[model samples]
Target: MLKRTISMTAAGAALVVAAVAGCGSNVQPIQVKLAAAEVLTQAARKTAQVTSYTVDAVVNVKHPQQGGGKMQGRMVYQSQPQLAADLTLDTVDMAGRSLPGGARAVLQGDTLYVKVSALQDLLGSSKPWIKVPLTEQGGSTEVRQLLDQIQRFDLGNMTQLVTASQDVKAVGTESVNGEDATHYSGTFPVDVAVQQLPADRQEQARKGLAEMEDVAFDIWVAADGLPRKLAMNGSKQGATLDATLLFKDFNKAVSIEAPPADQVGELPQSAPTN
Candidate 1:
């Protein structure tokens, strides 16, 4: 009887130990918020090191009454030698009417060449490609302003926004573009974010953010410390805008050349009225 009792007690203790070991194996590492911020900063630094990259973006716009529009586009940016882009606005729609065809833009050496489906009729030119220098004198004030805004859309500028945001925090880990990535989110005040910019850039950043109430960003950084995906949301004058970007082929060599001179045409002397 004594032997049996001792055997039973030993078995009970062994079972308890096994259960404790099982729980230990299932424990997850605690994530500190500060640690997450550090991770994001590191990731942003890594992204800034890249000289060139490609982005795929889908944009949705919603208005109170005029209806909304959707745009899908791809952009390639190369920083070395000079800033350049080969971009195609693959599809666009507004008020349920689809644009006739894809719109394209190319930037090379302070000049931007654009081909817009809607402008084809207005310009009355079969060449379709309109070349405008990036100077105030080349196009209307509004057109020049729009071109300036587009020129600032790049990954390095965006990473500055992330680093300067006070509300940035890590959300968690998730799969982005089929790779495991750490997620971070933040809301940034336009004025505050602008203040973080260099003196030379603050004015431009302020101008861009003036129309936005606030910008919300969500970025996913892959294990290699590079951003794999990013989303931005903002509202202005009762209209809501959302944009998503997928980054790939970092530091990859891309060939982008100016459109053939024969295929390019100058913007009409008479600018279209708004």
Candidate 2:
């Protein structure tokens, strides 16, 4: 159930970003006032060409029924040669509760290693790591699902949020990670964003977000024409979401190792969902 909880949270964040597909706020717009999508699309293309990168991301979700929490972490991702990632969950608090000292996860090849407090009692051992073999699910690595549907909000996917905007504008200039970049901002109405979704997804989006508010988005692209940062915010009848991604070290080598075998345990038939 922990998997499903993380998935649900990720889905909530996705719905907000995809639902917002827009940007606007403190960052003022300049005279350029170009269509934001142009910049976003260019940035997306440049980023996609890279084989790997490091991302510092944070997502916050607030819901009346499901409650809310803050999830922030630094992750290294590799797309060339193979798919791999290593990340630490700095915080995973929900409804005023949280995991003990947070959690950490690593995905190398088809194996995933997760280190969290929940594993201690469930496995009836003191080993800090629990190992699980991953398999391809549909088009994504199961690791992505295991780690809060991470692929859904990666830089590549985050950039796609712009395509749903109908009035995005070049806001101004800003420095991201010390690089000067163009800032884009705009807002998309709730109904309009849903219309932009695939027919198969439109219905689901409508029903799931029937009470959601419009999302605002902001994108900063460096002079090199790559995204420096991306952010989105929105709210539903009982939930509010705010997410931001900062990208850097494109195509950098990332090293990750599994925990020592003796320090790890095989996942039991029933994993802790709470």
Candidate 3:
């Protein structure tokens, strides 16, 4: 084995809460596929009822070049009714290599920092550091970008965009770890092609009929009415990456506090990517 590594570092920087992109996998339509785009949209609107919850995510990532691995992380999702969620992904890993070690990703509200240098053998010495430009733009580059992403997570609003869809279905019920899950399927709309991909890559994906075709997913929402397992297949037809998020162990007491002002890194007069 070449000690393979699949990094969520970009996700850490881009804050990809919706889903991961660039992973290669096959896709196909399902039987009894319901155009329940409106249902999801309605459910998202009701996100207000969900205030606090912890998530233990097991992300099995697969890319064309980078094989695959089951990554685990804990998330704390909080909200003020209609407001966006204050989310956090504690640890993300793949093939044994943990990127953003001792990482603490905060959404909007207060932020948390787990000194990577002080952490145990959770990371490597040569890991790539995120080079985010810091300006006199008030908050830290990390903080500002994080909050913006959270705000954009207007689930209720975005669900509205699920107007029409295809190849949708219900994969009955399955066991994720131990919890019961109901699976649903759907394809991504062409209108949102740019949303799931980078601008340049979006153009490439659009050259063929694949542009109009929707990306399919077998979303396993837990019986508890929350998203628990998500099997995001690729553009072709087989399983690309599998993600099972365990919501059972989620405890509310996961303490969250903002870093001290002194501990805060100075907004670069022109700081380097550390």
Q: Rank the candidate models, highest lDDT first.
A: 1, 2, 3
In model 1, how many backbone clashes occur?
0
Error of 3 at 25 (Å): 35
> Where does candidate 3 clash, by residue pair?
25-234, 26-236, 26-237, 26-238, 27-236, 27-237, 33-168, 188-215
lDDT for each residue of candidate 1 in 1-274, tens digit (9 for 90 to 100): 2222212222221111110110001112233444656766666556656767777777776777867766677777676767776767666665455556756777775887777646655667788677877763645444444445444434555666667677788778899778887888988877676666567666656544334668888988776667788787888888776777788777778788998899888766665454
lDDT of 2: 0.60
Worst 10 residues of 3 by lDDT: 20-29
Cα displacement (Å) at residue 157, model 1: 2.2
Local distance difference test scores for all models: 0.61, 0.60, 0.40
True-vs-predicted CA distance for residue 12, candidate 1, Å = 70
| Reference-based lDDT, residue 138, model 2 | 31
> Per-residue lDDT for 131-164 in model 3, tens only?
1232335434444444444444422222322323
Worst 10 residues of 2 by lDDT: 19-28
Model 3, residue 46: what's the lDDT?
40
Ranking 2 against 3 by TM-score, winner: 2
